[model samples]
Every structure is written in C-alpha cells, then in structure tokens.
Target: MTMSDDIVRMARAWIGTPYQHQASVKGVACDCLGLIRGIWRERHGTEPETPPPYTADWGEGGGQEVLMTAALCHLMPIDRQTPMEPGEVLLFRMRPGAVAKHLGILSAAGQAPRFIHAYNAHGVIDSPLTTPWQSRIAARFHFP
Candidate 1:
C-alpha cells in the first residue's frame, strides 16, 4: 500500500480513542498532538523526541508557533497555498492572532475533503473540511 493509505489506515485505527490531555494510547486516550505522535511512531518506529508538558492554553500564552516549528523540524513542510492531500498533516490556527496549535491528518481530499483529529469531547473523529475549518489552516506537512 501507498504511504498515504498506510497513514489513513493507521489514523482510522484510533477512531475510538477518547480525548485525554497529553495522552497517546490508542483506543484509550489521546489529544490532537498525541494522535499525530502515535501515527508517527507507527510509521517511523520511534519519536524523535518527547514533547514538553503543555496545558490547554499553552499556545495562547506563549505566542509561539510551537506546533508549526515542530512540524518544520520533523515533517516535510508544504507550502500553505498548496492543495491538501490525504495523509498530510494540517496545522490550524484556532483563532486570529493565536499560535497555530491544533493538528489533524487529512484523510480524504477532493470535493468533500475530510480530516481526522482527536477533538475534545468528541475523541478521534473524521471531520469534514468545511469552509470555516479550511480557513483556519495555516500550514501543511507530510511525514518524513
């Protein structure tokens, strides 16, 4: 199977995981970043480094693009203007003037694009890439 297919399959495997801050155990609990971290481990063996402890308000308080920075360091950066493809990582700015913190993996692309993310209160789910969500996309990357 293609790498993108592999990514989608692996991400789907965690669909039932509950949302838990800073956790990454499949089918048990994980946060958005944790979902990505778990997929990275599945595809690449081991994580390059462990993330530092962070709070829900971590990004807003720091004013730093920590998520984007980490993605740049480890993943293959894609131009923001580029069209998204399945299996690619998506970096979202939750609000204007805020650090790009939320993350999701593009699961389907085309007329009705979809992305999978560990969302608070909803757990891991494949959400449609609606206009509002698409507008929040700040950067994109691919697993390297």
Candidate 2:
C-alpha cells in the first residue's frame, strides 16, 4: 500500500480516542495535533521535532498560523484551492479571520471525501467533508 494509505489507515485506528489536550495515544486520548502526531509516529517512526507545551489559544491570540507554519515546515504543502485526497492533512480556521489551528486527516476522497479528527467533547470521528467544514479549510498537506 502507499504511504498515504498507511497514514489514513493509522488515523482510522485511532478512532474513538478521547480528546485530551496535549495527549497522543490511539484508542485512549489525543487532541487535534496529537492525533496527527500519533499518526506520524506510527508511519514515520518519530516526530520531526518535539513540540513545546502550547496553550489551546497559542496562535489565535497572536493571529499567527502556528499550525499551518508547522505543517509547511514538516509536511509537503498542496494546493489549498484544489480538491482534497485521502491521507491529506487539512488545517482549519474554525472561524473567519482566525488562525488555522485545527487539523484532520482526509480518509476518503472522490465523490465523498471524509476526514478524521478529534473534536472537542466528541473524541475521534470520521465525518463527511460537508460544505461547512470545507469552507473553513485554510490549507492542505501530506506527510513527507
């Protein structure tokens, strides 16, 4: 299977993990970044860089795209204007003009693209890429 497929599969394996700030563990707990970190660990063996402790509002308060910047530093950037693909990483802004701080892994593509993410109070879930979610996508990427 392709690396992207592996990443998608790994992400799916973490479905139902409780959402926990700064934590990363499949079937246990993880935040949005933690979910991505866990997938990276399973696919790449280690994180490119250790992330320092960060607040939930790390980038929003400063109006900085901290998550997108980190993604560009590690993953390969893709056209945000194009349709998504399986295994692609998405950066979400949550609200207009806000820093893109949320992340989700695309698990399906084509007719109905689905993304897997750890949502607050809901834990990990794979949801349809509805228009509401699509409109908030700030960037797209793939693990190198």
Q: Evaluated with lDDT, which candidate comes out highest? A: 1
Best prediction by TM-score: 1
Q: Against the unseen true structure, what C-alpha lDDT does each candidate score?
A: 0.92, 0.89
List candidate 2 stretches off by more than 4 Å. Answer: none
* Deviation of model 2 at 57, angstroms: 2.1
Q: After superposition, how far is residue 52 of candidate 2 from its true place, in Å?
A: 1.1
State in Å the error of residue 81, model 1: 3.3
Tens-digit lDDT track of model 1 for 1-144: 899999989999999899999999999999999999999999889999999998876578869778888889999989877877899999999888888889999999999999999999999999999999998998889899
lDDT string for model 2 (1-144, tens) is: 998789898998999999999899888899999999998888789999989898887567788777888998998999867767799999998899988989999999888879999998999999998989989998899888
Alpha-carbon shift of residue 85 in model 2 (angstroms) = 1.1
lDDT over C-alpha atoms for residue 15 of model 1: 96
lDDT score for residue 31 of model 2? 96
